[model samples]
Target: MADFIGPRLYACYNCRNRVALHDDIVSKHFVAGHRRRAFLFSHVMNLVVGPKMDRRFITGLYTVADVECSDCGEVLGWRYEKVHEESQKYKESKTVLEKFKIVKDNW
Candidate 1:
């Protein structure tokens, strides 16, 4: 049901522990094609370590779903809400909603 294709609209860089903006999305978000910052830790090593690293440098970490605006490819930040809701809807469970409680409580 989900299309995991080439060149994602959103990428989670585990190396930096943050989501990164793609070029297309950056262009739409900034209107000048500035490189997106904030990368997750996983991506950092992938770029620097190459295949020799085996990608185990950053394990046991989870990332939120990618977000991309249809009107434009702007990376509108992480969509934890949307991702959680969709997972709940598809799984026919309220677990995601329940998890939001703690996140909301902290806020």
Candidate 2:
């Protein structure tokens, strides 16, 4: 069973697309790091728009830009990936869940 509590439930701000449930949010990283927002892991299937190259937040490490909703153009957190050739999965996206509205009602 999922907690679906205050910070556990999250949906897109523009469109109520459920990006992640209780299980998805990265443990201990809740609302930490760059911004004080819930840092969760979302797969490509969960997001409406994919990651595009933006300015580097951590220079030479990863670059990120707005990840918007397909239905409504609302900024929902950001999507980022490693730049340097470290590993095979370095190119894979590692998004930090933020800017989403918590699902108030039943999640």
Cα lDDT for residue 72, candidate 2: 65
lDDT of 2 by residue, 1-107 (tens): 99545644466765676665656544325453455655646452256545566454332445565566555666666665544535524334655556334342234
What tens-digit string does per-residue lDDT give for candidate 1 at 1-107?
Answer: 99655443232222222222232221221111143332221121111111111111122222243333233333333322122233333221101111111111111
**What are the runs in model 2 whose C-alpha is more than 4 Å off?**
1-9, 27-35, 42-46, 58-60, 83-92, 99-105
lDDT scores of the candidates, listed in order: 0.23, 0.53
Global lDDT for candidate 2?
0.53
Clash pairs, candidate 2, are 31-37
Please give the lDDT score at residue 18 for candidate 1: 22
Report clashes for each candidate as comma-separated counts.
Answer: 15, 1
What is the C-alpha RMSD, rounded to one decimal, of candidate 2?
5.4
